[model samples]
Target: MPPHHVAWWRPLFLIALMPIGVLGNLEGDALNAFRQSLIDSNNVLESWDPTLVNPCTWYHVTCNVQNSVVRVDLGKAGLSGTLVPQLGLLSNLQYLELYSNDLSGVIPVELGNLTALASLDLYQNNLNGTIPDSLGQLSNLRFLRLNDNSFTGNIPVSLSTITGLQELYLSRNNFTGQAPDFYNLSKLENL
Candidate 1:
């Protein structure tokens, strides 16, 4: 065999020898972590196979043209689990819909890393803990609904920084302090 041919095939051989999950996509891993944490009695997440290259083909997951996860629509899926912090790894994620489930625990502060996020819906769950102040980092967020949960403490003042926020729902919670003034949220249409 020619030296040039050997070099070309060597890389392919090495890749083939790698373990099954070695080349798994980061986004897939993140979503798998979330799946692992959940108790899906209805098998709604049955298609969430971690062995897949990317999570784009998974049920309830949507990907953009670039094959990066852009949306996760699992609302009212009978899922009960704490939201995993690893979900923050999806940098291109624009929508996260996990509402009306039995999810508990605090919203992972790492979710603030999703700078592209446009909506975050976690309403009517059993979630507690103060909303992470880091959520203010989502400059592109337009809809945020955390109503009907057990969230306590004062609303994060940092939330006022999201100038593009159109809908903000903190109703039916146990917020004890006065709501922050969203002077910068001129586009807000809902409270």
Candidate 2:
């Protein structure tokens, strides 16, 4: 290839690499925010270095080949404290497994932003407050286990629209009023 051709490809490669760098930083910041909010008595999150380009290398965190955060496997790590809203910034997140922890406080409404989410496992925690209506936006979601929490309020009616949902676990919560009809949830096997 000519010198000019090589130079042209260099700029294009740099442009394509820019977003990955930005995404790495954004995801790193988001995960760091979670670290800041938690009480990691077991030092499970001690490897989460804020200066790192991305959290993909951190323990309990998983990322896709594109370096985008896809899952957070912090279940039963003895972590306590509230969830951070910055976690919603992980646009490509799929499975969020924060279950079986001592995490307290209301679930952040921002969690609804994880549109690509397929499995949301926040069960076995002390989360309170109403489930965010935004969670209904997860059309791709199949497994939603919010059971065993202190969450109150009628399930969001929008959830009934999730035809792809297979397992719905809202039991063991303090939800009041008649359960919203899941008659439309054709794929639901567990309620």
lDDT of 2 at 137: 89
Q: How many backbone collisions does model 1 have?
A: 0
Model 2, runs deviating above 4 Å = 1-18
For candidate 1, write residues 23-115 as lDDT tens digits.
Answer: 238889999999999999999999999877888889899999878899999999999989999999999999999999999999999999999
Model 1 alpha-carbon miss at residue 90, Å = 0.7
Clashing pairs in 1: none
Q: Which residue runs does candidate 1 get wrong by more than 4 Å? A: 1-24
For candidate 1, the per-residue lDDT at 179 reads 91
Candidate with top lDDT is: 1
Task: Compose the digit string of candidate 2's lDDT tens values, residues 1-191.
Answer: 77876677787888888985898899899989989999999999988999998889999888988999999898889999999999999999999999999988987889888999999999999999998898998999999999999999888998898889999998899998777899888999998
As a whole number from 0 to 100, the lDDT of residue 149 in candidate 1 is 99
